[model samples]
Target: MTVQFYINKFQALKPDKSSGHAKPHKVCLLLAVIEQIEQGFITTNKVIYNDNLKSRFTYYFEQLQQGNDKDTPYLPFYHLQTSGFWHLDVKPEYQEEFSALKAASNSNISRYVSFAYFDEELFDYLKSPATRHALKDALIHNLDSLEVQYQRWALSIGKSEKTVKNYVGALKGSISNWLYDAGISKENVLSIGSYAQYSVVASKALQIEEFRAKNTTGNGMYSAALKSYQSFLADVTQVNVKDDIDKILNDENTTATEKSTLVNTRIGQGAFRDKLIQYWQGCALTRYNKMQFLIASHIKPWASADDKERLDPNNGLLLLANIDKAFDLGYITFTEKGKIVISPYLDDYQVLGISKNMGVNLNQQHQDYLAYHREVTFKK
Candidate 1:
């Protein structure tokens, strides 16, 4: 595959940033380098001489050189060299076995590539079991196509067919073992006609297994598995399964209610818990840390909102008891810039005690949420 393809995939994984330190570009370049190395497109020896590789490296290095005022210089070159990219120095004869061992070891070199250029939080998330599994599934599904592309590339670079076959076999075996461990069945593995097909199946299996794990119930894994299978059908087949699932869950006519019960229990528990965790057990507006004092106050009232709007964190706030009550009653509100807005009925003394004590100046980060509250939730 061309460098652009890898760049696009890596970009999808990046967290959305409006401004500030441009950490994503560094990460993108680092992953691109590792990807090239893994596919044997660039070796430690060749990297120093290749004009394309040098140009890419120079772009990131220049950004770093610009200093912290404009962008944080997350220098990844030293980390990359130290963390095994340099080991591509292993003779071409041993390259096949080495690549196989590297993949099978689950050293998470790709994640390390990310770490060399991003923040600690991203590194931690990538190492997380859920995220790691997702990435592995994606990589496994793409491995065959990558290998084929690499073969064509190697031929252009004057590599022999024997070496190419050996490299491809090693990559396949390593990735196959990874998929098997992630719950893909041997039958499905054997049925695949090509590496690309195998990858698609493995990706589906991982998604289904993840969804099921998060939704398991007394009816057994089978029911949750079926739900996940249905979701995959909706995604791959584009059949709009949400309405179908919703109808079953909401059907007043159903005498048999297993599907409805499972759907409600899963959606309520999974989504609510995720929202609570994201807000870090506090009220967003009041900065209320006490669990009992905080409520996950929805921006749009629950009854009036759709499922997507109701669950959005941007549409939710952590508010303390009295503040939440005041907000709901429109007795007090926040400005579009995040400053507290007391209702006309509230005296200055009361506003001073609450809003001022809380240091409620509107910072840039909270502006959007404040705007939403001002436009949609705040009382006049």
Candidate 2:
């Protein structure tokens, strides 16, 4: 089928607006998945409704969701099965949840569906750059005027980003901080980028009832945060990696394991391994280019990556086994600017052959995942 055929179908997702104009949450989610595929994040087409997909979808929803008309990823993903191009796989365990859904009018659909998928033909076609870009253009053009209005206004308002970011932290304060200091309350993916015109006042405060009343306009944390950084992100220029990548490739490091990973590309397999062949041919931090025994390790463990992230080449690195073990065990991290950071309390400092002066070669994507590794895995 023609790309326009798919684009038309994608832009026609149903909208249910009880209090205000409908928002295009489905279109946004689809766009997020498409973008993930183009960026080589999703290796498989199984669109599981997990935190990773939600976080990725949040990137698009922050532009469309408004006031209490929340954008729940499950709702859009679950309902997409009605569209011939999408499919929801109902597992045996979800039988009870499915029964409960049919009994209630507005029941949560995700409780009944374990995963989602796209028609193979449609998914394959969307993988093309020309096709993906065309559909993304069609979706972006579909946002309602009101949604566009918020996006525009959000861009113009200026406020303390730190204040908005610290809202949850500030609310929990010293008391709750100590009580559940390690509570596993899931972290919401927030847009901490910049925004435009904002209220610098203590005028009439907004109330829940007041804001929820039909046609009352308000911005949520997601929308506001996206607006703050939308412009900045759009204007960001990519850093060149040719020199850095070349240095690693030419380094004396040559190993059998890394070589195997490098050439293991078999009709869609080893995409990340291929990236190790391209961007980084040697250890990420350890200048040990002597690749006689290097490992192709995933920064965000392969077992944990969502659809697209697992195959992201930038997420993998070539490292000597010892350095890889140290990094894999949270003993070290890399700064966003490509500096090596060692854990504060590593045992047996004399051995391990790890040096603090190890040079690093990475691009923005590498830096991004490294930040995640540092936050959740690094010892310090």
Candidate 3:
């Protein structure tokens, strides 16, 4: 009935562990439900088995599911009843069938269950952002163990124990200390709901007085730690972007014509995005380090580039959303020497966060791309 009680329940979900890693179905389902609630889909206590819910569930599944884990939303939908909070309302005529069922399948659940609802107290707790964040943090804390496994792997690959320890300690210590200063939990800052918060904390934590004092090796110590952490995150959290694109191209569900259109829309998703992320390490023009908020923008417009030029990392600039929009629409460009070149017509460039002081780092490889952008993409 209480928020802490539900948080405890979420943290202790009994997921299948026959596989080396716990199957992600139940947790992914919970995350999907929370997202739906946040997006106003689950307005009341009733939870419907709708397309939006299924789509979100599958999205999380793709992100979290590892070897041999199949996408089965129906399993969690029917089985979360055993968790003591999720209750299913089976139809009147199929009550006997629902009761007799040992396991659930999509077809049977569709036929027997009308909807699912949370226990009333639990539903009210979920509606509040703070409690929702707490619940999500509790669920995602499961990933902390995976970080341990990553450390072991790092050792196996000949990384020095001290080096690895400092890397881990730098990230964990800095973030936890920063959060404590901000009145959030001082411990387990690693599982703080989303990657955006983690990146933001890491950025702010770099400036903590204690950290600055100890970072006597210039930017080497903490910068190396942050990069290693980023690599670890990409390994555990992301699928190979190129492989994902190839799957879409090879899917039998889409015709060649449709595939062409789809591939164009997916231009930024391939190795280009990964390269930009690695190259910029953060936004090209700002201190914001949230990866999710950054856009991998091509300096030369994609439509104008040949195949070789389109995927080239040097042709890209990792930018914040507003900067990406302005650059894409030809309201802004940059000079060969990496200076900002705002279009004369864009009178309120300041409103778009485009300051006169803004510039990017450029090298010889970027010259051709910058020239093309200034000549063709710049408005004036």
Clashes of each: 4, 19, 0
Error of 1 at 294 (Å): 1.3
Candidate 3 colliding pairs, count: 0
| lDDT by residue (tens digit), candidate 1, 165-245 | 644443355334445666654542322323334446645654665434533532333332233233322322113323344
Model number with the top lDDT: 3
User: How much is 170 displaced in model 2, in angstroms?
Assistant: 40
RMSD of each: 22.6, 17.7, 15.0
Judging by lDDT, tell me the better candidate of 1 and 2: 2
Best by TM-score: 3
Which regions in candidate 3 have their CA more than 4 angstroms from the true location?
142-204, 213-221, 224-380
Error of 1 at 4 (Å): 75
Candidate 3 pairs with clashing backbones = none
| Tens-place lDDT digits, model 3, residues 1-380 | 77999989988887887887778788888877876676455789888886557766765665566668887899999888889999998899999988999888988988888899999998888888667767876776553364574464344333457877876786677646655776644656434444445566667666677656666654567766665555444433322332344565678987875555445434444456778898899999885787766777888876677656766889888887667767876777888788888777454567567788888888899999989888888878
Question: What TM-score, computed on C-alpha atoms, does each candidate reach?
Answer: 0.27, 0.42, 0.53
By summed lDDT, which 10 consecutive residues of candidate 1 come out lowest?
63-72
Q: Distance from true position, residue 314, model 1, in Å?
A: 1.5
Can you give the lDDT of residue 249 in candidate 1? 50
- Could you tell me how far off, in angstroms, the CA of residue 310 lies in candidate 2 after the best superposition? 19
lDDT per residue (tens digit) for residues 1-380 in model 2: 77778778866765666656666677668866775565455657777676547665654564456667565777677667677789877778767667566432224454566667787767777777556655655554445542234333233222233433433332233212322333422222121111111111101112223322311342343232332333332321101112222233354664645433332321112556446756766666655565434556778754445535655777777876556656766777788776778776454433566667765777777776887898988878
